[model samples]
Target: MGINLQKGQRISLKKEAPKLEQLMCGLGWDVAKKKGGFLSGLFTTDFDLDASVLCLNQDGKIKSNSEIVFFGNLRHYSDAINHMGDNLTGAGDGDDEQILVKLPLIPQNIHKLVFVVNIYNALERSQDFSQVENAFVRLVNLSNNQEIARYTLSGNGYQGKTGMIMAEIARVGDDWEMMAKGEGFQVKSLGDVMKLYS
Candidate 1:
C-alpha cells in the first residue's frame, strides 16, 4: 500500500524510494447512484471524466501541444509518458484511468508534469465533483506493482468544482518530487483548464 498524501505535501520519490524509477499514476472516482426522492429508485450516471497530463518546461510554461497527453493524445512523442486510455463511465474498482511514466526518461526540458481530471461537457451535464465520492489519485511502482502514494480528492473542498488538479511531479536537479495539489477549478472541461498552464 501507499501513504495517502495530504494537500500540499511533497514526496520525493527518487530520494524516498530509490528503486522506484518508473511509475504508473492511477486516477479513480465514483459517481453516486442517484436516488429519486419520491420513487427512491437508484439510477446510474454516466460521467466521462478525462485524466490529462500537461508537461511544462523549465520556465513552467507549456512548450508545445505535443507535451500534453489525454484521451485525444494517448502518449507523448518522446514516449516518456503514456496515458492508458479514457474511462468513460468512471466505473472501476481501482484505477479508472492510468498514466505510466518513466521518470528517468522525461526530457530535461520538461521540468514539471500536472495531472488534471475534468468532466466532459461539465456545464451541460450539470456535473461537478460534488456528485463524486471516493475520488483518489495514486502512484504505483510499475516494476514492482507496489503503491508509493495515494491522495484523496473528495469532500467539501471539491464540491461544485468541475476540475481537479490532483498532483504535480516536479524535477529539481536530478530528483523528482510529487506534490499533492488537491485543488479544484471551475472550468467546463479539460481544454479550458489547459489554458491555465499553456
Candidate 2:
C-alpha cells in the first residue's frame, strides 16, 4: 500500500527489521566570514553545523553504527581528509566533513525516531569561538535520494549554541513524516544520543 500523512500526526513503528527506505539525506551549516571583524559575527562564538539522514523501517529502533553518509565540501579542513577519519573542526572556510551513520535495527511498536547534534565540548572551549551551534536535520522522500521536506529545530536563541537538532520522525500511514526539534543537551559524542528518549 501507499503512504498517507497528516499535518501533525505522530508516527509509530512496531515490527523488528522493518524495510528501511533511505530517502534524501544531507547536511547544512552556517560558516563564519573570514575577513569580517569582531562586530561582523565572525569569530565571536561557535559556528553551527548540522548533519542528517533519512530511513523507514517496520521496527522503531536503528542500529548504533548504521552508515549515515552526507555529501559536502571541505571549507574547514582541507588537509588530511578522506572517506573515513575526517576531522571537522572550527577553522578554515566553507562546508567540510561528510558524516556517516550505521543505524541499528529498530524495535516494533515504535512510531518515530530522531537523531540529534551535540556541542558540549565546543561550549567549554573558549578559543573555539569559531565553531557554530544549533545545527539541525531533515528527511525528504527521494526517488533516487533527492531532497523533499525540511524538519527545522526549535528552542534556538542568539547565545544558545551547541545542542541536539531533534530528528523527530514518524510513520504516517505507509510513508514517513519528520519534524526537526532542537532541544536537550549539547552532546559530545554519539554515545550520548541514547538519552534522547530517556
Worst 10 residues of 2 by lDDT: 74-83
Number of the top lDDT candidate: 1
Candidate 2 on 44-129: residue-level lDDT in tens? 55443334332324454443333232223322121111122233443443223233322222333344545444443554553221
- Per-model TM values vs. the true structure: 0.94, 0.49
In Å, residue 10's CA in model 1 sits off its true spot by: 0.6
Candidate 1, 158: how far from true, in Å?
2.6
Compared with the true structure, all predictions reach lDDT values of 0.87, 0.39
lDDT of 1 by residue, 61-158 (tens): 89878989999999999899999988999886989999999987888899999999998988888888888888888999888888999998745866
Candidate achieving the largest TM-score: 1
